[model samples]
Target: MTDDLQSWIGRTRRVADEMATPLVRRMAALTDRSDVALDRGAVVPNHWLTMLFDDAQPQSQLGPDGHPSKGDFLPPVPLPRRMLGGRRLTYHAPVHVGDALERETAIAAITPKVGRSGAMIFVMLRHTITGPNGLLAVEEQDVAYLEAKRNAPAPPEKPAETPTAEWRDAWRPDPVVLFRFSALAFNGHRIHYDADYARDGEGYPALVVNGSVSTLFLFEALLRRNPGRQIASYEARTMQPVFCDRPAFLCADAPGADGARNLWVEKDDGAMAIRIKTRLT
Candidate 1:
């Protein structure tokens, strides 16, 4: 990494926000969990934090890709495309709605590499969340930047093979769902809502689903099936791009001997789009 890029490592920033009840209810509604109590004192799910603390950059500061222009909080890599690569989170305490929360974030690492498509850069960020009660959760997130590829050809499809699972749920994310998710995260990425831009500009066959949305769905499914099971820690990785309006299956295997459950989002073709591992308290 260039010295300039390396300087981004360990850079830290702190911000505060409130866990508003209305936003919590909106999140529940987005996940199709309107039954979730959104009373002021109700506990907010840790996964929902993904939609909070969004970078509210001014319109003039946004790049053509709709994200904040680089060289500010994040390093300015010349790459023209960006996406959420993966995340690992540890829940320390329950965060309640209406609580004022603080988040401290740091750039943990910056890695540059070459891929089949071209040059790439991976940024690792660490976030510590706290409330009046003290520490709430610690999260490590990965963001990837890539070279822009307009009209890129789709990869060849592989043979379908069903994965074993103890529980499964089907979800069809229409444009509305994608749009709402994008809005909730303050994500201005056109690929999630603009089908034309996604196809001709990004070379995606259809609108791409947000990685955080997929992660949220996995957690919702897990918690719904195993109510009251507290998640101590969880890690997730996006294996492939899941498009909007496609029928996807959220699958979870029986807990292993160590009590860690394996979860994944399976595309209609039986490919795993995202995989997760979680341990309960």
Candidate 2:
């Protein structure tokens, strides 16, 4: 594992740099996402780059039965376990088309944590991608996996949501959105696009969703629920596979003693999909 981690340190860096071009192209194709249109000649948007930061190199082979066997982090960073701690980003310069890039990598930290979820290993990885001219993007990603199954006790039920403002924005995700995000991240993993590949090849019942989108939705939920507050540091763990079209439920509670907002999300059956802690201002 030491040798594998060493190799991954450099490989993770490379993936960060190569991520921009595909990310820009793929994000520009999202016909219905936002008001900001990505001009082909222009550098990609902050959101697009944020999406790209999830890029990772293969660290190991899947087990004989096909799922990532225990201890395999091939497809490092966004591990199958859980992730948290991603926050504010500044787009220093537009990552333009054809910008050759490379990422500088470091194992920022690794330590043990104990919580209601039991023992866990927190791995912090820093990636800086530089382009033909200068720095394209810099991201410090904190990834963690509970050493044991993370089962959050059920929350006391709240009243049904009766909207003051009209319930707006499409809740369901479309195929195109998933495809565009997958392409942007340079993710060739079949679980996101090919339903059959997801079920038979990768062992998901349906086309599994992209984790980046979940991150975005979770962040947005934080903003909507806690207006005016700033997220200093944000972390989210992908606890289980989230597929396209599944309606999402997100929650962001007041900050804990660590000065970070506690946020979490899950898909239909309520498995822990993303566990997040956001630093507040």
**Per-candidate count of clashing residue pairs (backbone under 3 Å):** 0, 17
Would you list the C-alpha lDDT of every candidate in the order shown?
0.85, 0.53
| Residues 118-153 of candidate 1: C-alpha lDDT, one tens digit per residue | 788999999999998999999999998988884565
Strongest candidate by lDDT: 1
Candidate 1: 10-residue stretch with minimal lDDT: 154-163
User: Residue 35's C-alpha lDDT in candidate 1?
Assistant: 60
lDDT of 2 by residue, 211-242 (tens): 67766666665555545543444555555556
Off by over 4 Å in 2: 1-12, 15-23, 31-41, 51-88, 147-168, 174-176, 188-208, 216-244, 249-281
The C-alpha stretches of model 1 lying farther than 4 A from their native spots are 150-163
